[model samples]
Target: MAGFIEKKALKKFSPGEIICLEGDAGNSMFIIKSGQVEVYNTVDRREIRLAKLGPGEIFGEMSLIDGRPRSATVRAITDVECVEITRAMFDKILAGSPNWLGVFMNVLVERLRIADKKQRVTDSVEIGKKTVYLISLMLEKEEKTTGIIYKQSWKKLVEDISFLLDIPPSQVSGILSKLIFTPLAESEFNYKDGKTFIVKDWERFLKFTRFCKERYLKNITKGIIEEFEVKSEKEVKFLKFINEILKEQARANDIEMEYMNSKCSEILNEDISKYEKVISELVKSGILKKAVRDDGGKYILVDLELFDIKFQKYVDIELFENILKKFEN
Candidate 1:
C-alpha cells in the first residue's frame, strides 16, 4: 500500500539503542528481517525480561487500532534491520483485500474489545489518583486477594506507599492519616511489608464510581439529544459571534486565523455556538473581561480564581475541593 518507498528515510538501528519504550503509542508494526531485540519491564525493583524477538518475526501490531501504549519496552540486542508497516499503509492494504480485511478487522476488534473490558474494570476501582496504585500493588502482592485496612506502624506504611506512588514518605503518611477515618477492612495478615489495608471497601467505592460515570454518560447523551431536538436560530447567531471573536483574537495575538477552528474545537468541544452563548452570558454578567488590542482585535480573558501571591493563599479552596470531590466520588 506504500506505493512510493522512500529509501532515504530508512535507517539502521545501532546496538543498545531503544527501539521502543513501554507506554509509547505504537504507530507502526515492524518486522525484524535481521538481528535481534529484547523486550522487558521492571517489577518489584527487578528487571524482568519479557521476550526476545529475532529475524523474520513481527511485533507492535496491537496498537494499530486504538493506538494504545506499548506494554513493554523493546531494545535492540544487536544491529538490526527492520521494515516498518505504518498504520495507514496497513489499513489500506487490508481494505483492498477482502479475505485479509475480514481477518484483520476481526483480530483488531477482538483486541480492542479485550482492552476496553480491562480499562472499564480498572476505571471502576476507587481510591485517589496516586493512592490507587499502592492499593493495586498491595492486592497483587497478596495473590489476587482483597485488602485489609489495618492500623499499624505509620513509619513503614509511609515508606511502602511512598515508593508505590513515587512520592516522599512524609506525604504518604499525611495522605494515609486523612483516609484512616474512612471504611477499611480489618483482616489478619503477616507483617511482610508493614501494615496493610485489607479493606473490602474497594468494591463499594468501585460501585459508586461506576454509578457516577453512568450518570455522567446519561447527562451528556441527554444534552446531545436535546440539542438535536431544538431549533437552532440562537445557535447560528452564537456561531457567527464566536467566529468574529476568534478572528479578532487571532489578529490581536498575532496568531493565524486558521487556528480558530482548532481552538474552538478544543475549548468548546467543537460547539462554537454553545461556547459563544456561554461566553456572551459571562460577559453580560461581568464575570469575564474583554480587551481591544492595537491591531483592531478583541480578546476575552476570564479570571477563574483569585490568588494571594505573597501569602500563597487561594480565595476558593472550598470550590476547588468540591470540584475535586466530584471526580473522587
Candidate 2:
C-alpha cells in the first residue's frame, strides 16, 4: 500500500516550512518519501519536539482516521517530499485490503497516547508549583504598582500564566485558590465591583514565591516531553488587544472614553455594550479612572507606571498600528 501511494506524484516542502499546525482541520495523512520532518507540540508558548520522521514514516493519520483536529504541528526539518493520501483514497485502499487490523491498531495507539498524556499532567507537581509562584509574582507586581488588582487583571494574569507555563487555565485557577487560602497571602473580594485585591501580607507572599523558585528550580528547569493542552488562540489575541489599548492610554495619561470604546468594539468586532460590564469593573477597581472632560466629553485615565509594569512585554508597535488601520476613517 505504501509503495502504491509513493508511485503517485508527491508534494514537496522546503526546510522549515510548516506542513500542518495543531488544531487545524485534518483530512489527509502524509507518507514521507524522502528527507525529514519534525513533529512538535507547543506548550506555554514553547515548542516540545515529539519526533523526527524520515522516509517511509507516516504522519497526521490519527486525525484522518478519527475525523478530529490535528493534535500536533508538523514542519519540514530538511527539504522533504511526501505522498498525500486523502480520506477518499484511504477508504478505497482499506476496502480492498484486510485493513480491519490496521484500523484497530491505529485506534489502540491513539487511546494509549491520550492516556499517557493524562498521566504526565497528573504527575507534574513541580510545574504546578512553579506556575503558582509566577502568578503570585505577577499579582505582587500589580499590587505594588497599581495599589489594586482588578478582576480584568486577574483574567489576563491567568491567561498569561497559562500561555507561559503551558498549563490549563483551570489548573492555574486551582493553584491560585490554594495560594489565597495559604497564610502567606490575603485577599479582599469586592462582590459588588467584581474585583479581588491582595490587600495584606505582600512581603510574606513575595518570600513564598522566592521559596518556590529556590525549591523547584531544578525540576522546573528540566525539559520534560509532554502533550500540550490546547487553548483558544482567539481569546489570547483578544486579551493582547485589550492590553495594547490600555497601554496606549497609560502612556498618553488620558484618552477619550468614546474613542477607546469604539476602538475596542472594532477590534472585538462586537458592540461596545458587550464589554460595558468589564469597563465598569475596571473603573470600580481603580485601574481606570472615569472623569468628565472640561469640554463635556468623557475620558479615562490610567496610571502610567502600573500600566507599563503590566503590559510592557505584550505591546508591539507594528501590530498596534496595523490593528488601528482598520478603524481609520
Candidate 3:
C-alpha cells in the first residue's frame, strides 16, 4: 500500500478516441474527472448507446467489481480526464470499507446479471427472426416447384448471413441451430459438399418462422406499424377500394382495366382514370401481378391479406405444440 495512492495517474482522452472495447478483459475502472464519454454496445453493426458519463461519474466499474469481460465499448465523447483505479487499488479500498460496501457490490452484481440476461434474450430472438426471413426470401426467389434450393457451405452461409444482416456470426449460428427441431428441419447440411439445401414444405415452414420472428421483434415492428399507420391515412382508402373490386372480380377471375374503371366510377364516385397509375404502380411493385388463365385473356391478381407485415394470428401454436412434446417417448 506504500505507493498505491502516489502511483495513481490521471488518464486523458481525445474526443472520438476509444477508451475500451466490448468483450475485452478489464480489471480497472475509470472515474470521470472532466468532460464526457459514451458507453455503447454494437449489435448488428449498430451502436446502441447505453449511457453517458460526465464529470464525477463512473465507467468500467462492472467488470472491475465482477471480474467479467467488458460488456460494452467506451469512447470519449469530448476531451476528457479520468482517475484510473486498478484492481489492486480497488481491493485496497474495499478492504478498508464499511460492511455496506460489500452489500452494495452484491446488489450491483445482481442488477447487472439481470440486465445482461434480458439483453441476450432480446438479441437472440431478433437474430433468429432475421436469419429465417433471409433464408425464406432466398428459397422463394429460386422458384423451385418442390422448394429445393442449394446454398453455399454451412459455415460460409452463416458468415454470409451475419455479413448481410450486420449481426454477429455466433448469434446467427446459435439461433439457426435451434431451427433444426422446427418445421425447417427439412433443411439439411452437407459438410462434405460444402453446401446445404432446403428440401421441402418450405412455404408453410416460412410462414410459421416469419410469424415467430415478428412476435419476437414486436418493439422494432411497432415503429414500422406506426409508419404504416401514417401511410394508411393516405393509401388505405384507395387500397380498400381496389381490394374490394378485385374480390368482386373473382367470379369472372378477370381484373380487366375497363371493369375496374367502371366499378371505381360507380362505387368510389371518382374517375378510375386517376387511379390507373396507382394500379400500375402496384403491378410494378409486385403487390399486384398480371397473369393469364387457360384462355388468352390476362388478369391482375392481388393478395391484400398479407400486405401488412404484422401477424394476424392471436395464438402461438408453436408454443402449444412444444408443450405437447412433454409426452414424447
User: Who wins the TM-score comparison?
Assistant: 3
For model 1, residues 1-329, the per-residue Cα lDDT tens digits are 23353352244688899877778888877778789998887545545576899987877777665577777778898999887778877777777778866676668767776885665444322224345345444544444342433234455556677666555564455455444444433433466755554445554334333333444455556542231232344533443444455456653423333355456666555644446665565467554566666896655553333101101112122222333253332
RMSD to the true structure for each prediction, in A, is 18.3, 18.8, 14.2
Q: Candidate 2: where is the Cα deviation over 4 Å? A: 1-3, 42-51, 99-103, 123-125, 132-178, 181-329
Instruction: For model 2, state the Cα shift of residue 201 in Å.
Output: 8.3
lDDT of 3 by residue, 100-187 (tens): 8977996888798798777766565556666777766665555564435434345665877888987668666655555555554434
1-329: candidate 2 lDDT, tens digit per residue? 66677676378999999998999998899989899999998866778787999999999888888787898999999999999998889778777778686679678868967985775654455665566467666765552544343222456667888889776676666665555555544445466645453535554445445544544553566532221111234433544656678666554767776787788777777765665665676566566677997899998777566555334323332232232222121
Cα misplacement distance, residue 238 of candidate 2 (Å): 51
Stretches off by above 4 angstroms in model 3 are 1-8, 13-26, 34-57, 68-80, 87-97, 145-160, 187-193, 217-316, 319-329
Clashing pairs in 1: 147-198, 147-199, 148-197, 148-198, 148-199, 149-197, 149-198, 185-199
lDDT comparing candidate 3 with the true structure: 0.66
- Residue pairs clashing in model 2 are 44-166
Clashes of 2: 1
Model 1 gets an lDDT of 0.54
